[model samples]
Target: MKLHYSPTSPYARKALAVAKHHGLAIELVASNPSQNPAHLLAVNPLCKIPSLETDDGVALNDSPIICEYLDHLGQGPKLFPAPGPARWRALALAALTDGILDAAVPRRGQQAFPMDEGRSAMVGRFQSAMSRTVDALEGVDLSGPLDIGKLGVVVALGYLDFRYAQEPWRPGHPKLEAFYAEQMKNPIFSETAPPPA
Candidate 1:
């Protein structure tokens, strides 16, 4: 399997971490979406990073889908749970974390443009969403084996630290802080961390 990815992409990091955790052999193909790489576009019409090309010529796009695919390829425990209440909870958490990433990624791009009320308003809205999400996460139990939801939250927090250090997200969120700290101890995160921007 080959993974088309940008080193700085948090979404790519999530997929890569899942692959590493499951001990799946995947070739990392460094790709820049900005350049509109023909190879990437061919596989993913959206031209997104973290696209996975399987040995059978099948292509999987989106971080969650790619991670789930990689999880199935190995003998390791599943990050996504089987159908049940646990599955719903995991999926809900993953959705919240991914939504945070969704808002953040575009906001970063908007930063390249001039700062205006429109940009500020958009950023403010995202900040509010993040704040609420973090608050909610603080109350949720992150115990038991690591799952996709936990991985998603950790990666999302990492992305915030990497790109939005000015945003004070850790001051009051002790649980989230501890969760992130514990996850960072894992080599999967430290090894695949994005370079300083």
Candidate 2:
């Protein structure tokens, strides 16, 4: 399997971490979407990072889809729970954390442009969404064997730490802070952590 990815992308990091945790043998192909790389464009016209070319010659895009596909091929216990309340709970939490990434990643990219009123409003909205979502995550149960939800939390917090350190999210969210600290000890996170910004 080949994975086209950016090391600093949190979404790509999620898929990479999952593959590592499962001990899957995958080739890492570094790609920059901005350059419109031919290989990536061929597999994914959207030109997204973390596009996976499976052994079956199938192409998969989107981090969640890629992660689920990798989970199916992995030898370890499943990150995605089977049909049940557990599955719903895990999916819900994953959605929340993904929401954080959705808001944050774009906001960070928008920083390259001038901060006009419209852009500033969008940034404010992104900040509000991230703040509210993190607050909601604080009271949730972060304790569990590694699952999609927990994995999402790890990636989401790591992205914030990597890209938004100046904003400091650790003040009142002790549970989240502690959960992230503990999860970081896992090799999936420790080894695949984004480089220092």
Candidate 3:
């Protein structure tokens, strides 16, 4: 299998971390994730990073879809819960984290390279969205006895550190900091953790 990705994207990292946790080593087709080539676009309509190329030539897009496929390839612990209320809960949390990340990237893009005033508003909106999302997570259980939802939290916070540590997030949210530290013990988390540029 091959995973098309950029090393810094949290969404791409999610799939990479899952692959590591499962002890799978895929060919890393790292690329400029924002620019889609014709061949890559042929694989994913969105031309998004973290597109998985199955051995048989099937292409899968979106981190969740790719993660699910990776889990199915193994007989080990499932990253997603089996069909039940818990499954949706875990999935929903993952989706929420992804949405927060989606909001943040554009703001970072604008502030780092603003073209107009509208980009500033977009950045502000995304930043507020992230703050609210973090606040909502205040009392959520972050202890992982090895669950997919927990992995979602780890990746989300780690991504913030990777891309926006200058914009400190955990100082006012010690619970989040503590939670992230706990999840950091996993080798995959550390191995895949992005460094500041």
Candidate 4:
């Protein structure tokens, strides 16, 4: 499978991590969907990174879908639960994490739109929403092996590195700091680490 990706996209990094952690053989094809390239539109109408192109030429968009698809291919070391409360917990965390990015990614888009006129006040609103999400998730228990949801936190951290480095989110959140430092060590994350520069 070929994963359309940007080096600094957390969503793409998550897909890469899942593949790496499970020892799956997949290829990463760097793409800038933001550029709205013609060829990319054929694979994914949404024009987003982390779209997985199956061997059969099917394209899968969105990170959650990609992650679930990757999990389906894995034999062991699953990131999500089969069925039960644990699954719900992980899913909730994943949702919350994604929500944070949903807001930030756009704010990021606005800030990088090349013209201030293209930015919107709602972009700042979305950024505030992400901040609240970080606060809400700060109390989560992440003292053990990471669940898919826990990875959501790492995804957000990577987003911060990509777009919100000056946000001062970590100094007050020890739980997340400790979790991020340890989680970042997993080859899954380390290998796909974003290029902040």
Choose the strongest candidate by lDDT.
2
Instruction: Please rank every candidate by TM-score, starting with the best.
Output: 2, 1, 4, 3
Model 1, runs deviating above 4 Å: none
- Report the lDDT of model 1 for residue 167: 86
- The Cα RMSD of model 3 versus the native structure comes to 1.8
- Clashing residue pairs, backbone N/CA/C < 3 A, model 2: none
TM-score versus the correct structure, for each prediction = 0.95, 0.98, 0.91, 0.91
Candidate 2 Cα outliers beyond 4 Å, as residue runs: none
lDDT of each: 0.89, 0.94, 0.80, 0.83
- The per-prediction CA RMSD against the true structure, in angstroms, equals 1.3, 0.7, 1.8, 2.1
- Using lDDT, rank the candidates from best to worst: 2, 1, 4, 3
Model 3 per-residue lDDT tens digits across residues 150-190: 77788888877777778777877889888888778888788
> Which of 1 and 3 is the better model by TM-score?
1
Clashing pairs in 1: none
Candidate 4: RMSD to truth: 2.1
Worst 10 residues of 4 by lDDT: 112-121
Off by over 4 Å in 4: 112-120
- TM-score (C-alpha, index-matched) for candidate 3: 0.91
Task: Write candidate 2's Cα lDDT for 36-77 as tens digits.
Answer: 999999999999988999989999999999999999999999
